[model samples]
Target: MLYKLNLEHILFLDIETVPQKQHFTELDEDVQALWEQKTQYQRKDEFTPEEFYDRAGIWAEFGKIVCISVGYFAPKGDQRNFRVTSFYGEEIKILKDFKQLLADHFSQAKHLLCAHNGKEFDFPYIARRMVINGINLPYKLDLFGKKPWEVPHLDTMELWKFGDYKHFTSLKLLALVLGIPSPKEDMDGSMVKDVFYIENDLDRIVTYCELDVVTTAQVFLKMRNEELLADDEIKKV
Candidate 1:
């Protein structure tokens, strides 16, 4: 499937998210009860809602996007390289800037959005966050009545599934198996919340997010049987 993709038309991306509040106690009493109900079946008889609050960022309702890093291919004569950029700071601002970028540069019907596990995670998370922030959905993310075949989106992890529902792969694992550089050099998703809220290091998260975006693109290229980009080929703008 990747054989036919025009690298120029796809916007490769990854996002970082965190719970809206620093801790479960910060949420009001009513919402706390709701979180309990939300996680009861998953939590079972183990941890309480407060004990599991750190994982709230994985759910769109209780979380907000902290960063969204995107990459695209640039042609250099006979070669193609990737350039990355990020939208971050406040969640609302990040969503606004990212939305404007899509509206301005990649709004055409042929433009595609790609990410690892994006169909289940990044894409829906972004759309839900935007709606919660009262922001209008961008054309690419506003699924509406569009048929599955008509949606301009790609998922590398989904492709790797190969119709087997029992299999699952992480982006880092895919990078390792595909011989692409692992983007989890410094911090993984588990550390993102601490790095953002405690350390107050937005740059670290942005850099990490961009690396994942690049790694994801590289994984896609490898699957397409194309040469991976050299370090010198990656230009961040």
Candidate 2:
């Protein structure tokens, strides 16, 4: 059934986020107390709230999306060209630009958004960030009253689960097992915060995010038993 679906109708995407502030000390007193309380269970006796700040990017309330890279397949005569692009820079601007893209191009009912672990993370994180930024949710991201089957969203991780609810697979592990080329050669999710705050290399982070998009697409193609995308077919825009 996945193979029967049009590749052009799906958008594969990945996002990179970092703590709202460069450091824990940057947050005001009241917010610091809030952070301490929010992460208490996770921190436990191993680490203090301030010590766990680096992981705050996993939470929409304390994190900000710095980049969102998306890739879509476009039919090219006898072949398919996978084009990738990114929206980065100021968080509000990035959200606005991405919102415009969805409204202008992917508003149709047939269009679907795909990512690894998207249902649990990427999709909701983007939606929450959009609300926090006061941007209207695009049709694809808005799920107020849509039925389960009516939702136009896909998750490579969910597909891989195949009904095993307790199973958890990281994108890197999935790609490795599926024989798809590794996308973490340069950097990975763990190093994103330092790269953004210390190295100030957003371009690097963008490249990393785009690679994950490509990898997610490849994973979907693998699931459909389709040919993998060749290097020449992937174009960064």
Candidate 3:
């Protein structure tokens, strides 16, 4: 099925997020209490709200997307090339930019979005953030009355699950297991918050996010029994 899908129509993407503020203390008392309650089960009794605050980026309410990198395959002479681009810095501005990109180019019915664990994480997170930022939801991201089959989202993690929901796979582990290069060579998600806030290196985070998008495309190709892109074939544009 994936083999028949047009690579050009599939927009592969990944996002990087950080806690809305530089520190947990920056949040108001009400929001702080909410954050603590949200993670209570996971944190148990060992980690306090402040201690687990580094992970606030995973929650849409407590975080803001700092980067949304997208890639798609296109004809480059006689061969296909994958080009990557990113929107970063100033949360609302970047979110609006990304929304405009989708509206300007990828909004057709034939277009689809592909990401690893996107159905559970990336897709919803983006839609929720878009709403929070006052951006209209594009048809592809807005799942409101669309039938289950009508939602054109491709999740690599869900595809790999094959109906066995008992296990979950990280993109890095799946990439290594499937022979794709690890995109985490420089930094992982755990480092993204610090990279954005303390190190003040949004470019590094964007690069990391772009690499993940490329890796996701490669993983999807692998699932379809297709070839991965060569280093020469990947362009950051």
Model 3 per-residue lDDT tens digits across residues 1-237: 887899999999999999998888988999999999999998999999999999988989889899999999987778979999999988898888888988888999999999999999999999999899888888889999999999999999999999998779999889999998775458989999988888998889988999899999999999998888989999989
What tens-digit string does per-residue lDDT give for candidate 1 at 1-237? 678878999999999999999999999999899999999998998998999999999999999899999999988998777899999989999999999999998999989999999999999999999999999999999999999898889999998998987788999988998888664469999999899889999999999999999999998889889889888889999
TM-scores, each model vs. reference: 0.97, 0.98, 0.97
Against the reference, the lDDT scores of all candidates come to 0.92, 0.94, 0.91
Worst 10 residues of 1 by lDDT: 176-185
Number of the top lDDT candidate: 2
Query: How well does candidate 2 score on lDDT at residue 12?
Result: 94
Cα displacement (angstroms), candidate 3, residue 14, comes to: 0.1
Superposition TM-score, candidate 3 onto the true structure: 0.97
On lDDT, who's better, 1 or 3? 1
Which sections of candidate 3 miss by over 4 Å? none
> Which scores better on lDDT, 1 or 2?
2
